[model samples]
Target: MAFSEEFLSELRARADMESVASSYVTLKRRGRILTGLCPFHNEKTPSFTVYPETQSYYCFGCGNGGDVITFIKNIENLDYVEAVRLLAERVGLDVPQDSRYDAGLFERRRRMFEANRLAARYFFKALYSEAGQAGLAYYHERGLSDAIIRKFGLGFAPKGWENLRRYLNGEGFSDRELFEANLIRKSSRSDRESYYDAFSERVMFPILDLRGNVLAFSGRAITPDAQRKYVNTSDTLVYKKGENLFALNLARKSKAGSLILCEGNMDVVALHQAGFDNAVAGLGTALTEQQAALLSRYTSEVLLCYDNDEAGQKAIRRALSILEKTTLHVKVIRMQGGKDPDEIIKTHGPERFRALLQDAANDVEYRIMQARGAYDVSTSDGKTAFLTDACKVLADLQSPVELDVYASRLAEETGVEKAAILAQAGQLRKTVSRKRERDRLRDARAAAAPAQKAIDAVNPERAKRLRAARAEETLLASIMHNPDIFSQIKGEIEPDDFVTAFNARVFAAVGACMQQYGHFSLSMLEGDFTPAESSAVAAILAQIPNLADTLQECRDCIRVMREEKGKVGRGEACSLSDSDFLKLFKP
Candidate 1:
């Protein structure tokens, strides 16, 4: 729904920014602002700042800032209208809909949600039916309790090829919609009339968005000798594989401060049921940067508890690399006797698992320990190689205190002198630093003008006339910094007097904001902007800090802009040849 500026402003006024943010983040008041470790990224320090005066939040670490609606849209992955409605509902205010609101996109999303919900119901019903004996026995063998199974909405996709396809189509979904939902696929044959279910003879795990809507599914093969063990829904209108985590809807609500990063859906289920309610997993895939980023928003730290096997260890290494790139503190848990979490909990019980979580190795320590197995340090050559590679890893540590401790540990492990190891690490850091500088220089040298063009991408000749563009930007900023100046100069300058479509649009938006709110705010104008446009507008406004000479500045900008516009008009009318230029210079 499109809301009027007045209504959105009212919603912003009513919604509690701190309370809403605290629902997901643990915030502590700092002076007039409430501060928290940014949920948008991993950080040891509190960089997610909430300004109560404006009722908005900004993360200094991630550069994510906006009002309450923008916060909900980002954190919950909802659309703008959905986010507005969420905040409206939270404050017990009805969302005022504007006639300009187009419900097509929202309608399509709702249809997909309905399809998935009905499909999940059918699958759940089938799981308890006679046809689901194989799936039922498989879960029974895995020792999954009926309560947890049903709670997680575990189900069985039947062995019959068309079971789901026929059922969903009969329930009023078109074949194209079913295909779009990724529930079924058209036949490989020339005749498109025949279609088959995407998953069969597998245990179904419904993947939900934060709002508890079934957006997709992950299916684990129940067939004893199946070629691939698991299959997941491809990207659909409602789901993006890399952007979601299984059980996060429930997990984010946990009072636990940290989350357990497991590998599979069953493992996540096992962890959650074992009194670790903060466990979440990627939907049948390795941890992705998107998922890692999403996790950073909900928890301050992540404990990676992948399986004990080599594959799990490799996954842990890959996940750590990605997670470390974020601001989150990372830890690792290597299962003592089981291949995965489900097995570990089954064999060792919840208490033992909790103990393992408590004693989980810090990521850096775990990396160094893992490095030990990659190289044998008994021989002199092997010792040198181990120290060199180990120091290389240690050099990436951001904290000097951490580097010192790890360097000493590396020296002790390889029987090398601590001084020598530190020296080697220092050299390695220098070498890495030089290489990065070279890479940056190379990129700079090879770079052309930005491929991302504005509405008006100007050539060199056109750029010369963009002197007015700067003037236009300054005029906009002057108005932005002080709104009363806008009315003073309203009759003096026309919108078309602004050169460059980018600036002209910004000027128009400012005019509209003034008319509606009787004032201007950069944040209020964010709705009508693309990220690129927003950045451009912000850059322009930031360049002029003082509005001390608004009247003079505005008059000067208007005068310069008119001169530039006159130049463009004259230049367009008369094209001078090179000979004409040479004749003019001849005395």
Candidate 2:
């Protein structure tokens, strides 16, 4: 249903920012604001501030800033409308039904979710029933407890084409919903509806989102002859492979600003059952940027607990690259004997695994270890080669402190002087910096050339004016950052008077916000424009110069232009001639 402005306003009023944020973060009063550890990124000091007066929250550490609806949307991984509906429901408000709302799509998605839920329940029942005796025995042999099985909703899919189909069909679910949910398929020859249970003769793990919704499932096969060891739910309308994490619902509640990232569902369950409740696993695929961003929302640090094999090391490296963009601190847990976290925990006990986590090394140290394993460093030539390759790896470190530390370690390992190592580091940094600068300039030139060419061909005079107007817009942005400037211009100027369309839009948005709320905020306008418009506004703000003195400068320029116009009207000889003016202003 299309929500009214009043409904949204009422929802915002009922959903107090402090109260809602306090549910996830421990807030301490600081004057009129509330200070807490940023739930979006890991930090020792609290940079996440909540302005209760304005009903908004922002993390200065990260760049995430928004109102209550945005908070719920980010924290709960819901879209804007869903966030609004959730908060409205929380406050006992009803959303008005309207024809604009696609009830059918909503119903279809809900039915798919329901189908997955029912399939999970049926699989769980089958795991313990007579039909699941072999699966139960397999779990028993693997040392998994009944409580653990129930905790993870572990289940068994019978080795038949129609087992799940029969159960879901008997429950009155339509074939279309089942097929769309990836729960069934049709036979090629006879057109018989066959249950395409993604999992069969395997132990199933139901993956739950942070909101306790069953989004997908992962299953591990038991038989040696199984074609694939693990089978996961394919992407559906409600479940995206890269967007959901296993057991995040429970892990986000961890008091420590750290989480254990495992390679599989079994690892997560094993850790959780062993009192490490802050364990989560990525989808049966490699860790993605979206998954890393999601992890950033819960904790500040992550311990990678992937397998101790070649592929596992590769995955850890891939994950490190993906996580490098996020604010989450990353460390890799190296398993000594076991191949994976579950096996290590089962063999050496959970305490040993936990102790290993405590001693886990950061990415640089882990990469050094990985390099040492790959190359021999005994002889002088070997040491020289190893250092050369390792320095390249160390250069990828984002923190200068980390780079320095690793450089020193590399010097020690290679018997090279610290000064020499530092020189190499400096050279690498310069090379990388120059490459980045060139790429940036290339992109900027590419973007500007098209617009510039269009302007040059169509209207050079207007283009020059537009560029000047852009300079003015930047000045306005700088002024807007200062509350005193708004007071100065409150009665004297209007945004509609701006010359360029881009500047006019930004000024209009800011002016409307100031009029309505008595103040202007950049975040209030995040969703009000398209991505391109936002980028244009950001570019203008970044390029504008002398913001504090912009008003006087703009007024002076206007006066000069008017004076020159008056001189031309008097038919006086200008700086050049009429032909010169024509050439300069010609479109």
Candidate 3:
């Protein structure tokens, strides 16, 4: 799926970076670049910058720098090929079908998509068949209507080993493709290879992406004797379980201002059927930071509608901790007379559940109530413990009026003086504020050296020869800033002369770009390196603004790398003795 440089260039030209970025980030002109708050990570101050000249962007706060394609890839959660296609469609340019494309990673993912799509169709067809009668009855017992079932593309996996295996095999899918899609499991018995359906006698729920492609499945067992009532698709080529929400594809389309976060697929469907279409659930996993960020993208708030049990309460706490870091407002939906949303809707009806949602508690209110439940506020020691927990929760409240309101309530409940409670909460708030500021300072220092910090995790030698690595980074950054410098430094520093493999690869790529286009931009490295590597390269070049004399700095940096290269056993510096390492880095 690789595009020609000319097509990419044309696409980049038609889809201006500034225009494209403005759709997501509220950017303001800053001399040669534009700045905005980063959408990748939550930040109060704007650190995300866009360089229209290079058709590139880099975030100082989160280090998510890349070309427009990379931006779309991360923002929309798509693969490289998909992102390119999206950008092409955006600019009204048809992606050229290049047969030279390797049928490796991208092709494998395509096959998985096809397999999942066909599997979903087969399951839905099976739901209406004789084998799926019990599953249909199970849905009926749960009160899911025919229209609601079809809207969610509900299906049934029949009881047997070869049901899906036989159907998909007839549909021209290889066993490997089905296995990779998590639709079937492979087995070897008596020296013969065999495959079987992964789900059996279960009501099938096809988890889809934003594009409405069936990515995976979560099945609830229909029979009583079946082990593990629910069996979800393992992470496959087409899906990462924790990275996706179950019904988000449909939920995203809901006009509802907030999303109701549920615990299971049934709860989501039930809530959606009851006119709460913005309900979504995790894919058979606990809430993830990634999922939380995904939720923040579509909604202004998230209503935690998990079950009314100990495990569900724990899940709510875990979810609040992650969601609190995002910009989204969060509330907890405390259910009554039922275990889960489905049970609540079934028992007291959806109207009662709707009323509960209307009166849902904010995260702070929820935390304070949880604290009250943890200890007896009437007793002295219990009152102290409750106050301590309540103050910790109150400390995070951003609004002064809200904090005082909660504090006054705590004082009234415990019969403690209102001023004393306020004083304790204020002290806790100051302590938390100091700790956050210290963390922010430490992170700022780490971010200052993002290039070295990023490489240190994978390239140990880069850290050992810090002087040489920094020099290499500067030389590369200079060349990226002014591609003409490559002509001057080409003879002085070749790829092999570099100490770091990643920098060497980038240098080689830069040399190739310079030779072909006579200029280099961050977009040239789009397909060659990973998203993280591209961001690191952007980070390296972000330091170039201070370089007054690019040609001389490039030469000076090249000289430093050459000096490091002249050392004996160049790459062995990382394994050297402490004194030897110090001497190797000596000026």
Candidate 4:
């Protein structure tokens, strides 16, 4: 439902833009604006600027400009009501129960979360039953304790197709809800039920959000030689495999100072059970940029503890490339005496695992070692090639001391001069800098294109009437930035005069906000517009002109819009000069 303006205004006051954004981004104050690396997209330089004075933000790199609610909606993948509710709870304000707002998707998502919660409970209860003996035995054989199983909400799916379906139905969830939650599947056979369980005879690992809500599950077969060893819940309304990591709910709270990135749920569980409470793994997919950004919010460092296999090494390298763009410090843990973290903990004990973590190699050291393996350094040609490859790795180091130390190490190992290695690394750094600058300029130009700014996905007419749309956008932006100008352009422009539907809606919303709140504010638009619409509105507001020609700009915009709207019907509007159009508008 739509919140009252008073409630939203209060919420906005309580949850300011700077405070809300600082939790996810490390923002630094520059005069009145706070700047930081945008969490929405990966970038080295800080283009995400938060204006505390106006309680808004805009990313110059990406065209994502919005208020605090918009920031939360985009960063957390939440809808308008969900984002508002999250912010409301933060400041201890209860969301109103008014039913004016269309909260269809939000209510559906709430039901989906509830269904997943109930399904997780049913699976957990089934794990202790006689039907789950094989699954329980598998966990025990893998050295997972009963307490750890309960801690992680580990469960089991019985060896039938309709077990979870029947259970959820008994819990008042319909077949459709269960299916939408990805807990059951549609049946094909004539004699079977309409829907059957999605997972069968497998050990269920509940994947939860950071708030401890069960979003989905990953199931592993109990048998050792099963054809399909693992099955994960497909992407649904509440869960996305690539966007979420398993066990982050508990890992984010660890005082361990760093997160242990594991290869699988079992490995994360094993580490957590062995007193490493900060272990987390991806949800049956490779580490993604979203997952890496999520990790950076909770910890300053990430230790890559992949298995000691070729596949694990490759995953670690891929993860390194993803995390390189973030500010998080990275290190790679080399598993010894076993294939994976679980096997190593079982074979060498937690103490040995601790030693392995302590002896973890920094990313640069690991890369250098990896490069050394590709060459025979004993030969002169091999030494030169290895040095060349090592210099590339060293060039990425940000610390001068680290560069010097690594350069010295490379010289000692390859019989090359330290100065020569440093010189090569410096040259590589210059080349990288130039390439990065070029890419940044290209991205900036693309973002600043007038076509991009004027085009609206919801209103295709904006492209057909590009000139009018541009003028309408400028007028709306000006009125929002300076509400006093609303009086000057009061009778000259109306929402109906706008050439595009989307911009018309925006004009009406801006007028309504100004009338109701005595100011142009984003809080009133939270539930009134969709998230995309809200983002587009914020982009418009970010175009506040520097020159104080509000009256002239508004008149010109109204004249253009009038002529354009008239031209849609009559050919006489094409013959009207600027002065004649101005006479008609009378701004």
| Candidate 2 lDDT by residue in tens digits, 17-48 | 89999887879998867887677654545767
Q: Write the per-residue lDDT of candidate 3 for residues 1-587, one digit (tens) a residue.
A: 27778888888889898999888777999898899867777655677889886778888766777788888878876777877888899889988886544486767877888888888998899999998899899899999999999999999998888988888889888888888788888776657887888999899999999888888999998778887999999987678887899899999999989899999999999988888999999887888877886786788899999888899999998998888767789999988879898988888888899889899999889989999899987798999999999999888777899988998888888899989988888899999899889988987875556545655654567867888888888788778777677887787778988978888998899899889977776777766777667777777777646542657767888888888887735557657888987886778
Comparison by lDDT, 2 against 3, better one: 3
Worst 10-residue lDDT window for candidate 2 reads 450-459
CA displacement after TM-score superposition, residue 562 of candidate 2 (Å) = 19
Per-model CA lDDT versus the true structure:
0.77, 0.72, 0.83, 0.84
User: Which residue pairs show collisions in model 3?
Assistant: none
Off by over 4 Å in 3: 22-31, 34-48, 60-63, 188-191, 446-450, 457-461, 484-504, 526-535, 544-587
Query: Per-residue lDDT tens digits of candidate 4, residues 379-497?
Result: 88888888889999987777899999999988887778889999999999998778878987887786565225533655688779988888888888778777888867877778889
- Candidate 3 lDDT at 210 equals 86
State the weakest 10-residue window (summed lDDT) of model 4.
Answer: 449-458
Tell me each candidate's TM-score: 0.83, 0.69, 0.89, 0.89
| Residue-wise C-alpha lDDT for candidate 1, range 1-587, written one tens digit per residue | 16677787778778777889888787898676788876665555576777665466666545566667778877876666677888899899997765443545556676788999998998889999999978888888888888888888989998988999889889899887888888998888875476789889999999988778999999999878988888889998789888899999889999989998888888898887788999998776788877887898788799998878788888998898788767778999868767887888899899888888888899777877776767777878777777777888877776889888988877666667888988888888888888868966764543312221322342222365567876776788678766788889988888888656667778888888887787654457655786555544544443333333658778999998888888876785578677775776798
